[model samples]
Target: MNSDQEHYIQWQKKEEERWEALCGRCGACCGAFDKDPCVHLSRDELKKYYCTIYENCFGIKKTVNGNDIVCGSIRTILHSHWPGDDCCGYKKALKEKN
Candidate 1:
C-alpha cells in the first residue's frame, strides 16, 4: 500500500482499538445500576456482558420492567453515574491522559 493509504489504514485501526479498549464490559452501564436493565444486555458463555444488538445499541430502549428509556453510547454518559462504572476503561484512560 502507498504511504497515504497505509497511514489511513493505521489510523483507522488505532481508532478501532481505542474505541474497543474503552469498554470494560462490566455490564454496570447496561443495567447493573438500574434495578431493571434493557433486554439487550446479554451475558456470553464466559459471563462477559455484551449487547445483543450492538450495532443498533444507540437509541431508545426499554428496561426489563418495561420502563421507557433512551440508550446511547457509553461515551455520552462517561462523566455520569452508573453501576460498576468504577472499572470503566474510558474513565481510567481519560484520567491518565490528563
Candidate 2:
C-alpha cells in the first residue's frame, strides 16, 4: 500500500483501540443488573466483567434466564437505556463529546 494509506490504517487501528478502551467492563449492557446476564458474561478477580465469547459475541444469543437476545455493536444501542448504564464509560465519553 501507499505511504498515506498505511498511515491511515495505523491511525484507524489506534482509534479502534481507544474506542475499545472506553468500555469500563461493568457488564451492565450484558444484563448484569437485570439479573439475567448474557450466558457468556464473566467476572474477573478484580470484579471487572468480560465476555467469554467476545470475539464471536455478535448475533443471536441467550441470556442466563434463557431469554433470546441479539447482540450487536454498543454504538447501536448507546441511546437506549439499561439498568446501570450511568456507569458506562462509553456513554460518559459520548456525553462529554456532545
What is the C-alpha lDDT profile of model 2 across 1-98, one tens digit per residue?
Answer: 99999999999999999999999999999999998889999999999999999998999899999998778999999999998999999999989999
Candidate 1 stretches with Cα past 4 Å from truth are none
- List TM-score per model, in order: 0.85, 0.94
How far residue 71's Cα lies from its native spot in candidate 2, in Å, is 0.9
Give the number of the best model, judged by lDDT: 2
lDDT of 1 by residue, 26-80 (tens): 7888785667878888888888888999988888888899886678777789788
- lDDT for 41 (candidate 1): 89
Error of 1 at 4 (Å): 0.4
* Candidate 2: regions farther than 4 A off: none
Q: How accurate is candidate 2 locally (lDDT)?
A: 0.94
